[model samples]
Target: MTENWLNQIKELKQAVTHSGKFHADDVFSTALLRYINPDIHVERVNEVPEEFDGLAFDIGRGEFDHHQEEKVYRESKTPYAAFGLLWRVLGAELIGEEEAEKFDHRFVEPLDYNDNFGDDYVIARIISNFNPTWDSNENSTDAFWKAVDWAEMILRAEFEQIFSRIRAKEEVLEAAEKAEDQIMILERSMPWKKHVKDLDLLYVIFPSNRGGYCAQAVPMEDGYQELKMPFLKEWCGKSGEELQELSGIPTLNFVHSSGFLSAAGTLEDALEACKRSKELGTLNEGKQPVLLNVSHGISSEWSKEQIKAAHAYGEIIDFMLPKIEGDISQESVENFIDDTVAKILATKASVVYCDGETYLTYGIVRKLKKKRVTVLGACHNLNHEFVEFVELK
Candidate 1:
């Protein structure tokens, strides 16, 4: 808020805000203002003294307070608490327009939501805990300042990490510019996942700390397990000479069973292996694997941990996971078998995974075994699940 009061507050380097049982809004507002100008004086009171001409927020129903009838909300529909209000006016300007949006989404929004609506967030809980206990003799005002100091520390650490990620993104882009072909070789590994998917890369060959080099297939899209191109089906899950004989790369080392990644003896070996995979390898296109979900009567999306476990075997995808309202019949369930098999044939899915009505899951698995697919059962909890793909003709 570029109000006359705000202009004066910047020059005065002092602010006045409400003081009672404090919330994250006021605490972080003070912390952020102190971060900007450490010497700024902050006075808390039951009422913002009328004689006080300096900036007042989180009180007086001024620009930063959220208690007014007409509330302020961001474009995303999240209402602004005092901290969010101040962040939009000041913190965004301090960092940058782009970085500001990302920071607001990841950090600021949760606290704002917690304060405006009733919710439990660890950061908000930590600040609220600083309030003097009902039986404790400790002063509340002094405790407030201590919480502000800690909030400033938390903000500084988080911002520094974001700055480092910014620098890493720049370095990865510079390397991308120098790449000659689909295989982009990095002298050393930096975070390249965010930058590689949209580019024309099929494999990113980088130095592996474990040995010589590693080649990772670029995902077809972000946040999906599908790769643009995967290793040859014959080469997956093999080590040493076996992988060498299959891949026709004498120096080849190993390829993950999922075919999304591989480790090779040398940089040259990585480059050559990827070259051969492109020329001969065809999976998702020729025989690429997928972790198919057949949610016949079950209704649940896989969690990140579940997706991670399934990804070790192949790309995770949903097939015939329909949302059914009425009861199912034997005829309707039986009819799904032919339609499901037809969909699988349309794609070159090698590895299959299923979770659904128990009888249908087993029946589909038996039918898939007759096709060119490897059907496997899941055995574990969400915390730990495993799928060992034993090839079935």
Candidate 2:
């Protein structure tokens, strides 16, 4: 049995409701209605008047109430609270049918479960927290309205993220089509990692924000629990001059401890590392690895003059000092350097170059060296100094 609530909602000048204590269902229902038609007003009431004119909900003896002997249940047998009921009738009209159904499953289903079954779901708890406490001096109606504002913001942000993922999918598909047999080289970085699971690729090479290219081994499956072909264990946990000497690839920068990823100074060197990895895989089987000539340069930083000079050497990862207004404490500077190192590590940068101002601080250089990440600093006019050459226990 369907109510003509859709058409009835349109004629109502304001949403008439019972107030005092509000539940998630009532708050969400009011929010959704207001979002659909911003001009509609909300008038709280204690009793259902005999000659009620506007749309009545929650406490009123109207079609929106679920407290009566008759109840509403979705196809899945979950009881529909006021929010679910309203969503079922009018959700598709606001959003498309497919998205509305998806939203109901992802967002509305849990709320309905908590409202009907007395479950302590997070969303229900969040809405309940907005209520005025017993000792508080705030008005109940004001508190209820505050929760409505938060609910609207949550809904809008979630919808935006969902649509963004949909658009990213198209870009991933196009890249997959043109990808090499065992590797995919993306010109720029994006949220493409999630969309490449089913493709028959082993490695993904892309330009890192830290400068040079990064060669990341694609996991055998989702969650990256394991890789299709990991970098050779011989170079694991090694970086800087040592990594370059061991690999005999002058441009090699770092190899993670797990051997799942490695970095190179240039695209050519990154691809060479990939080739070496495949060779090791084949040598273990008494076979030869397939070789491919793939090289390209990408950089979000570096001026045209700088690129021309440094392109041959690959990407240069540098950290420069920020301008400070007044005297700075050593503790604060150390904390800042720690945070900067953390951000660079998150990108799995192989080597990081520091400006003379930052390098003058011996402790900061020591901290970067401890991470096993290659650190280069300008010491004097003649040449650049390598922190890797400094011995630290």
Candidate 3:
């Protein structure tokens, strides 16, 4: 038979949980129940009575608890805490399934991981701290209630953001459909990038909450620093009449110096700016590509398969050997790092496969990032010999 109690949770009057130290899993579970039925009474006890029939979780080794010898786990292999098990059953009933799934991934899974495995999160830590200290005079029951109240605020905030994103989707999609010359215009400001990033859009124009309309470049690929097409270099950092004069857009606010974002006083001006930018073409159209290798112990550091992986990102790998014969000094290390970065900018290989001493790699990566060079890192899978190149953060 179906669980009449679970189905009739809206009418639930009394709930119970184990008495003792509390955690986010149990705290959030209580907060969620309170969110559903504000008047429901809650009890924390060491043991539940046989005749007592009420919502029970994180205790009694009942439906919600996973402390038993055999346990239930998510398909992703994350063990379900009391909170997660509750969410899995009733989350869709509260919010639609899609949004519930998102909430579970964002909030539930992390807290569940903290409860099941040793993974830590701020929510878990804060709730755990709510438990009275061994020497504290504070009441445990009061502390548990305080923690539940905080979890409710967090849960409410997450739902608000999720709902806002959902609302933005339809508006973003409509604008994308009406896009002209690779430009999308939003009627009001909302998050638009995630919805249209994969679309054939070079620029997006939206009403800025700070006033005026904003025009922005689309990234070449998500997480890539490069833009599909950046705004004109000449218009960058120009504002007021200066920007208007350069672009012939009558009402201009300011065009950022980076050429990735700009604000115009009117929607017409924003569109005009995007149109002019498309005509100007990409900046540094002929900036060379280089593949420089400046690491000590090249042959030993890299396998033949790893060397082949490096070549996939860029063509030539000029293995520039280190120049110190005896003990190396800090100055020599600095020189090697500086020379490597400079050579990379100069050759057919700013796009790189970087491997070196930890400190040297750090310096090289920092400098290359500033110059807008793509940095590559290796990822090896279960098949040890196979190596793949991926963009490094």
TM-score of every candidate: 0.68, 0.56, 0.72
- By TM-score, who's the top model here? 3
Where does candidate 1 stray beyond 4 Å? Answer: 1-12, 49-54, 245-251, 283-393
State the C-alpha lDDT per candidate.
0.74, 0.68, 0.77
What candidate 3 gets wrong by more than 4 Å, as runs, is 1-8, 92-103, 118-122, 233-242, 279-393
> Which lDDT tens digits does candidate 1 get at residues 79-117?
988888888876555676788877887689889988987
User: Tens digit of lDDT per residue, candidate 3, span 231-338?
Assistant: 988888788887788777798769877687899888998998899889876744423334455455464435435655544333446565554567888987888878
What stretches of model 2 exceed 4 Å from their correct place? 1-18, 32-65, 68-77, 86-106, 133-138, 279-393
Clashing pairs in 3: 289-348, 289-349, 290-348, 290-349, 290-350, 291-349
Q: Candidate 2's C-alpha lDDT?
A: 0.68
- Report residue 318 deviation for candidate 2 (angstroms): 50
lDDT of 1: 0.74
Candidates ranked by TM-score, best first? 3, 1, 2
Error of 2 at 184 (Å): 2.2
